[model samples]
Target: MRTGLLLTTLALGLSTTALPASAETLHLFGPFKDEHGATAPIKGSASAMLDTTKNTLTYRFEDNGLSGPVTAAHLHGPAADGQDAGVLAPIDGPYTTRMTGTLQLTPEQVKEVQAGQSYINLHTEKYPDGEARAQLTTDLTGHKHHME
Candidate 1:
């Protein structure tokens, strides 16, 4: 009986260790540029963290020396760098030097983000096309599940 109990306890411990974590944290960052197929002096940077289990994204961004007031911002994707696509998520702002927020994403959106095809873009009064843009890439500095 004592041996049987010890074996059962060991088995339980092994099983628990093999269980997957409930949530995963993913990080992304980018450097912005003019992606409207034009040349501009505008510049910016952005970073974000996604909690896969909660389907929430927390992001912060900053820009400087834009030619005009920022009219809009968004996460746009399913396209490669230098390519343009429709907005995936709109970011509310008369943007300041820094902006931050947390947003919930649909399962489909999350999939697109994880696929490395999404980008952040800032539209300005002078460049209704988009004065600054950044392609978001997975940080990969920590553990992340393979999206395959």
Candidate 2:
């Protein structure tokens, strides 16, 4: 009886181990090049910690080189260059050069963001409307995502 109990426990443990691990973090990098009026386009990197279980994303951005003060920043819907869409989260920045924020996403928001339906953009004083932008898409193509 004891042997059977031990085997049962071992089987349960093995089954649990086979469960897929949740994705807790995502590293995203791309360039932000907009000739519309940017200082000359800048490259930036972003890292996000996603609480997939909770549907939240905390991200940080580092714009290695850029000019002028940031006027506005936001996470937008997934779309290519010259495409327009609504905002996902309003980043609390336009501060200094680098920006970071912890954003809580609703179920629908999480679904969209995970589906490669989100991008980030920064507006500068010189380009009050918006000068730099980067769209996030699946890396299945093995091509580096770019910020345009």
Candidate 3:
């Protein structure tokens, strides 16, 4: 349950009145844990590079222990931590460690990401709902947070 986080944000338009229309980049990261919270402790980490200039969200993942092979991976969103939302995009995978890829993001999706409303979920047969869940954040550090 080590929670060490470093969050740095470089956004073109930080103004409340306007959405960024210029170059923006977000270095976001977080750790993966059992979706049911403390029911089963899995280990992993995920990182993301959201570049508005390219309209792409590049995500990378590291898996330590999972109940089973990943059945699916996705960027689920428009919700806050501990909440559930529909998949905003599917992460391509034969899923293995260092799972990383770039995904095109809509303007609205970018907004969701910037607002801390999106998360990455890795699904497996043992837990079809989600085996690894990382509430994506601007944090550059922090691998796992244990339930208190």
**For each predicted model, how many residue pairs clash, with residues at least 3 apart or on different chains?**
1, 2, 0
* Residue 117 lDDT in candidate 1: 76
Off by over 4 Å in 1: 1-22, 139-148
- TM-score (all chains, Cα) for each model: 0.75, 0.66, 0.77
By TM-score, how accurate is candidate 1?
Answer: 0.75
> The CA-based lDDT of model 1 is what?
0.76
Native-structure RMSD, model 1? 8.4
Give the per-residue lDDT digits (tens) of candidate 1, residues 99-141: 8887778878877777777888888877887888877777544
Candidate 2, superposed: residue stretches over 4 Å from native: 1-27, 35-39, 64-67, 138-148
Error of 2 at 13 (Å): 15
Question: Model 3 has how many clashing residue pairs?
Answer: 0
Tens-digit lDDT string for candidate 3 (32-118): 867854365567777788987667898888866787788999999999888899999999878886677899989899889988899
Q: Give Cα-based local distance difference scores for all models.
A: 0.76, 0.66, 0.78
Arrange candidates by lDDT, descending. Answer: 3, 1, 2
Candidate maximizing lDDT: 3
Whose lDDT is higher: candidate 1's or candidate 2's? 1
The alpha-carbon deviation from the true structure for residue 90 of candidate 1, after best TM-score superposition, in angstroms, is 0.9
True lDDT of residue 116, candidate 1: 72
